[model samples]
Target: MAKNQVAPIKGMTLPQLELMAAVLGAHLGRHLLDELELERVVYWSDSQIVIHWLSSEKQQNKFIKNRRKEINDLTGSKHWRYVPTHSNPADLQTRGISAKEFEDNTLWFHGPPWITQPQSWPVWKECDTTVLSAIENTETENCSETAKDKRMEPTSNVMDIVQIERFNSYQKLLRVTAYVIRFVDNLRKREDRNQGKLTAGELQRAANMWIRDIQHNIYSTELECLRSRTQHHLIRQLKLYIDPGNMLRCGGRINNAPIPTDAKFPLLLPGKHKFTHLLIQDTHQRNCHAGTGTVVTLLRQRVWIPAARQIVRSVLRKCVSCKKVSGKPYLAPAPPPLPKDRMLDSEPFSVTGVDFTGELHVKSANGRDKKVYICLFTCANTRAVHLEIVPDLTEESFLRAFRRFISRKSLPKIMMSDNATTFVSAAENIRRLSQSVAVTDTLCQAGTVWKFIPKRAPWYGGYWERLTGITKDCIKKVLGCTYM
Candidate 1:
């Protein structure tokens, strides 16, 4: 038979905890938990607690009687309760806080279920909202826990039940509203108004989220705590991350906020708690309703939040300062169109574009040359080129070079050139003496297209432009002169 074995009753009182660290040869440190990160705390309005640890059943019973004597000796405050090891959450927290939180976030404390907590706490917990709807309508309590249930005669085994319920006047009005709407089934019509103030228990639901309590920071404390971690692979979660409501007052302006999306999770906080203007304003007003502070005081209690003119007014005014300074919303310009067809060089010189771009003083091979003009012809198909320089650009000089250029191949059906004064000039197009004055214009062939654009339209003639810029840079680098 196995004997029941409990761990030795070694209660490391605050001082003893420090001593144990030295015995184990580790440095012990003390630090207060941040307000937001604290959890599993209990508050008493008219009572106090005295703690003692007992190793055996005999000692446990003795400690109960000695508790009053100890309180009367050291601290006059006296209202005590014995909590079993299974229910003491502080056991888990003493091991983790601050730097340890990251490593231990997924950990949860096991509280031996308190029958009283589940029963009386339903006012806060089993708030499955369906009950709240019933509460709002003042209809037959949709919740199984009605006034009659609360008053049920208790057995001797029942524990002390703490009542934490607080109803709202406006909330009551909302219930009235809900009754009317549900009676007629007009939910969609008053959605905006209904969502705003009236709920079976609006703040009550929020209180469940742990945002509504601030007096002792009950819910905020729990949320700040690390009782839970997201199960996402990345421990991810989707949250607003910034409240459009408090917006810049806390984090910054709209421009600074990250856009909301479905995929985001494993959130850093404050961003997760953001609300829309209407929602946050309602929260702030709710905070104000607690009667402890002004709007600024109430807002400041949330520390990061800044004061606001009004949630609705601020959202409507559309402050550029707020948007630019913060993550604000705005429509962006659409992207430019993409090329539909893929194009490439088919052959070396089959498709050619010829253009003259110079007034250079290059020397001719003849000894007496004062300056030489380059008459260049480039093949669009092959991108191959032939160049000659002659100082003059007259028709006589042009035609002489042209004949030599045409000698290399059958006259091309399609040729491209720049829309320079010389290329498009009446003289160049007229052929000097034909009665039918032929114009030099772009023409398309089966394998190619010949075209010339007006000056400075480099983008339209990208092939030539790309090559020209390259050649121009080379010339400028070599000759110490800008491109012609």
Candidate 2:
């Protein structure tokens, strides 16, 4: 049997709700055992606080005492045991689930799997006394009349006047704070109220007011020690002193220098504060998005932020404009592993990459100019080159060049080339010729496989392409625009 109830709308603490749940479970269990004529029944609760309250002999308030008595009378302390919240099936009922989830859930129907095995049940451990004591203290205070009076007391702080973290820009915060101060002054004296644009003095006063509030909030103890003429280790080494306006300023050794007063004794600011971040951001923009070193130098001229360099670096790192202008491109991944043909150790030109270079003009014996092309065959492994000059790019012309190459070097088992029309046509012609009756049996048996790379990817056949470049360079140096 299972039962659940919604908590009262009047509001109740978590421990109070948990105790009420224990009472509900007790009522449900007692009715089930009475109606079914069961010999024994066990009760389980996820809240250790309720279990401790039921077992404890200590006196409790009327609210907890009454509920505890009802639960003990119905189920008895011996039947109560602790269960982990996650393993308790009632937890799902407290927090609703979708209809689909309710249909699929088995824990609600059968309880935790360990409920069938008595040895695996959760062992009872002592509840933390501190947690119980805190709950008791809270309950006691809530019942007292003085607590209600304390709650009615008004609390005020600087943040109640103006929230510093609400503004993104330091300049905007200063203007808004100045306006607030002006409005307050006008309320005090209706006549002769300052109106129109705010003067420079008002803005400066607002900035000082904000700075003083922030320092007092963060370093209240240190400020108190300084005011009482006592030493505090946190700011003792900085030689800090209060100015006439009651704002903390650094009293360094350079006070006697010819520089300005603000430069010699800059105002102290906490580096991790939100106002400090806004100040750094403002200075970064005013300097036309300068580097960290430049921003730090400019900021230190009037304000001394501890760990200024680190804070400036962090602030600059988040600037979108700087990121867009100075960010580096994504690095390319490493090159893939070399192909099997290129890694094989064999005779030079056994596996070759072939490509065509260019057309050259040479004088024939009849005093007529003829066009010639350079057919480059480079070793895939050794990078050896074998150049052959052909009259044209036709299959017959390239056949003769291929025959010359094989006759000079070892017969290439694999021929890799780009998918040029000349190479494709020559490969087709060689395939047809190899099956002809005129070809020798030895030549037919030792047939070479031609492999064409992907279309328009010259880098696939770079072995021969690079050799063609070198051959062109050599020709340029030797011929020097000569035809022959």
Query: Best-fitting candidate, measured by lDDT?
Result: 2
Model 1 misplaced stretches (Cα beyond 4 Å): 1-351, 358-373, 392-397, 426-451, 454-457, 481-484
All-Cα superposition RMSD per candidate: 20.6, 23.2
Using all chains and alpha carbons, the TM-scores for the candidates as numbered come to 0.31, 0.47
**Which pairs clash in the backbone of model 2?**
none
CA lDDT, every model vs. true structure: 0.37, 0.82
Evaluate candidate 1 by giving its C-alpha RMSD to the native, one decimal.
20.6
TM-score between candidate 2 and the true structure: 0.47
Over 97-188, each residue of candidate 1 has an lDDT whose tens digit, in order, gives 57665455443332445624734321211222121111112112222223334442222111112112322333343344344444443545
Q: Lowest summed-lDDT stretch of 10 residues in model 2? A: 134-143
- Candidate 2 structure quality by residue, lDDT tens digits, 1-484: 5678878998898899998888888889989998999999998888888878888887788998899889888988989998898888888988878899999898888889999999999897774432333322332332343334443212224566888868999999999988988897899996999999999999987888878888878888877776565668765566676665566777665644788888987999999999899999999999899999999998888999988999999999999999899987898678688899889888888799998888888988897999898999999999988899998998889889998999999678889998878889988987787777777576666678899988877767776887898998899889987878
